[model samples]
Target: MSVLPDPGASRAVLVGTSQYEHLEQLPAVSNNVQALADLLRGPLSLQLPDRHVTAVENPVAAHAVLGELRRAATEASDTLIVYFAGHGLVDAQDQLVLALPHTEFGRIETGLPYDWVRQVLLLDSRAERHVVILDCCYSGLALGRMSAGTGLADQAAVEGSFLLAAAAETRTALAPVGETYTAFTGALLEALRQGIPSGPALVDLGTLYRHLRLTMEARGHPVPQARDRNSAARVALGRNHANLPAWPVAAAAVADAPAGPDERPWPDPRAIRTVTGFLTALADVRVVSGLTQKAVSGRSAGSMTAGTVGRLLNRPDLPATWGTTAVYLSACGVPDEQITHWQAAWQRLRTQSAPAEAARPAATRDGGSGKPRVWQRPMSTFRRRRDH
Candidate 1:
């Protein structure tokens, strides 16, 4: 019994600092912020508009940190989510402070106060729900009792607010030595992408919190803490992917296959049946390899220029020759064996279309009296180029 957020109305500001001046650098924090942003925008996940999500990473100044939060808070009318994954400091007054790239431990003033983040939402935001996720040391300090100067456990909490902290008041969050994301954010992403089994169709904050806590505890990681007020925990975060229908066997195999050691996800070429399909798959391989047009040209030793790569990807017709296609794939780091698969697919598609192409008319040179019967070289622009 939950609903997805209105994609146009919700706003999210993801902030994380991976580099530090006085404290140890957290390289995984940047990954956390980026991966979360991708999950929030991906069509398979939260389905939020790309523009509605903002990511601020490794800020050197507090202004940049507060500026994005203030903007997102002011704009959001449905749900406002502020996520911070970096160092959390407790000042002399025991207030939660978010560390920046240039933050110094002795000079806590250089960091942004968690209270300022709350005030921005409380005072400026018209959002119906406010969700704050903090993944840092002593982040739970932002949600404890407000006993004199024992640190305001979220002083003046918003009417409908949910604050999730990665660690308890005296604990430190952990970033595993070889992980891409910090422990807390990593688990959070997993829940969003993997979904909760035996859960409802839509995943609300309450379910997500349960999954996070249990999963982390089972893995011997820090168990997160949550302070939900006025049923803010009921707000749906995203659809439960686990409850979605399963993919077909063929599709599942392709989707689940791991990338090669080079991090290239060379697609299976057996599925391609048309010029468009073949080229589209080839373009996808280039994208997966993280190769730019210029990079491809350079990698291919200038056999394929950047301009040629750009045009080739956009063009619907097949390349002028097999050599062109092979060069492009080789530039994208496709193995010779895989390149052979692509070559076979390319030939099959061309041959399949050849009969229809052979009957097509050409320019009126002999008053169109004769069709490809007069001249035949596959009767395609791709073939015409080579003939000329």
Candidate 2:
């Protein structure tokens, strides 16, 4: 694990606007800001004191927001995070602006210019690391004016900065009715709280972004976007409460057991009652082996990519080819002797789903459509017959 910055040296500015002078009010904005603030101050390793956190609610003037940002820029020496939950608009020039309580639709000058916020937080801030999270429509436009020279390799040239937007430049950010936070912010909070599975003890920007993007997209919500220029991918955002070691030492001991079939007690494939049950067992084995989907893919010599492994694990129905299942089990360090048991289980499942002709009733075999009596044999019986 990489060393984390001093939590005490970090500062945060949370701005939320639920009441607008002209636009419709968003009741969830306040809840969004409060939930984020609580996370940062509570579980997040950023032991940011209440004094270091500047929270602005329904600021009528753009200067007030800028003033809080300027203070954070001057005060923070290690890390700074600025979060906004409200409305976002694009001016005629395609520049993004934050909508304050008094911001009008046509008057861009009245809104807080995202460029100014970026400049102050990324360029002018004394902090070593900077993070900007926007939960509003057109938030992706926040990166529209970033310096073209700001490439991932130019980490030294540009301070480590990460920008996360709730939606695309053209899409509207959604707030599910009656929910406390918008879809994006809610997902963000959930990811942060749950942490990445089989990842490091500390969650970073890259991991958080990936989780956010996948989760929101899966829920049919607007896709979020991230712009990272300061090698911010590795910077720790918070401690992962859900972090688990890749592999337990005891598991390696189990793997060292003799591979001989005579000495090994293979589990009965018939014990698996349902596809979901089999998948749950497979997932448990993977976790115990301490290998991530990416690591499992690499161990498989690239035959199975990380995405493929994820899909296989997520879906209750096994892959079409038993070869894929075998590859995954082997990669997860399942004993070769035990793998055959899994393969047998997989074959049984496939046979159960095979064409009706394979095991059609006597009446059906004779082409008599007499509502062919359904064969309701237990899996154990089938296993017994196959053994014979």
Candidate 3:
């Protein structure tokens, strides 16, 4: 668990443009902004006040978005975050611009310039740390035009800033229609909601970026790119305030059990409705058994690695095979009867999840629906590029 400096204040500017005049309308953009805002305000998360968050939706001009960014940068004394979810374009001169509602195709002046946003963030002396999250095509270009003379290492030495972009310079970011969020934002929200594995009271930018990258790649989406300039990687983005007790009474009881075979008071397996709930219960069982992930891995005789155990406990989905589950249970010293209960729970969850998984859209070139609506223009050129 990383300890963060006591940032005096935190502020955020959330911008999302779903309704565009000359470009394709991304319906998921609105949901992306809302979800990020909710997570920032969550009790066990950032805990920012309503006044600290400024949300701009479907702005007609570049100034509308830039004005909010300027305000946040000037007002925030410690931490500032700017998030944009919309269309992005690279001009003939290779400048990246964020598209607004009234932005026209190839009209670089009409869109918000990424350089101007970066300048505002860099010039803000009030904020000690700055974080920029972009979920749009060509967003990686935000850092492309940054001071050319300064290398990434040099930039990191001076400014505490970070950039989280959805794709590389030539790649397109995707926002699947009908989904609550874009692939990148969905992974981000999940990371914040779940917190880091093991015992971490803080969620750092580095951990979040790694999670986003892995999640997007696993789902066959574009690999997200992260640039850490300064100490932003170590700076805490959110607090993990989950109400997990340090020591459970059940754990003490299990520890004091007779030497031959221990009896543990586990929760009713039938009550677990989701894969996360099942993994959490399993984690609790491990805590009661007083075994670390390494210890459990050792108990499995290297059948399962600590990394595998961590993923099994943290991932939203269950492990791929029943054998993995059995090995994990055996490592945790789970009795045969309890293992049977867990197996039943896993079967029920699998039965319920099959239809839901089948209903999801497959990973396509556009990463969205097959057909475009009458008002929407097809992003034929901006196809999704999945990582191998």
Best by TM-score: 1
| Tens-digit lDDT string for candidate 2 (1-388) | 2334444466899999888777767788899888888877654444456777888999878889989989988887767888988877767766777888888877988788777887787666888778878776543232211111112122112346777776542433376667778778888888777777766656778878887788777887666677777587766666564774435334344456566543211223444533544664566456546667777877787789989889888874555678888888887777776788888877776676577546766545544565533465677776675586
- By summed lDDT, the worst window of 10 consecutive residues in model 3 runs over 143-152
Q: How do these models rank on lDDT, best leading?
A: 1, 2, 3
The candidate 2 region of ten consecutive residues with least summed lDDT is 143-152
CA lDDT of 56 in candidate 1? 95
**What lDDT would each prediction earn against the true structure?**
0.72, 0.68, 0.67
Count of clashes, each model: 1, 1, 1
Q: What TM-score does each of the candidates earn?
A: 0.59, 0.57, 0.57
Give the candidate number with the greatest lDDT. Answer: 1
Enumerate residue pairs that collide in model 2: 246-290
- For model 1, residues 302-342, the per-residue Cα lDDT tens digits are 79888988888877577647987888888777778888998
Measured with C-alpha atoms, the lDDT of residue 127 in candidate 3 is 79
The superposed Cα distance between candidate 3 and the true structure at residue 341, in angstroms, equals: 48
Please give the lDDT score at residue 173 for candidate 3: 35
lDDT of 3 at 315: 69
Q: In candidate 3, which residue ranges exceed 4 Å CA deviation?
A: 1-8, 139-158, 169-173, 240-388
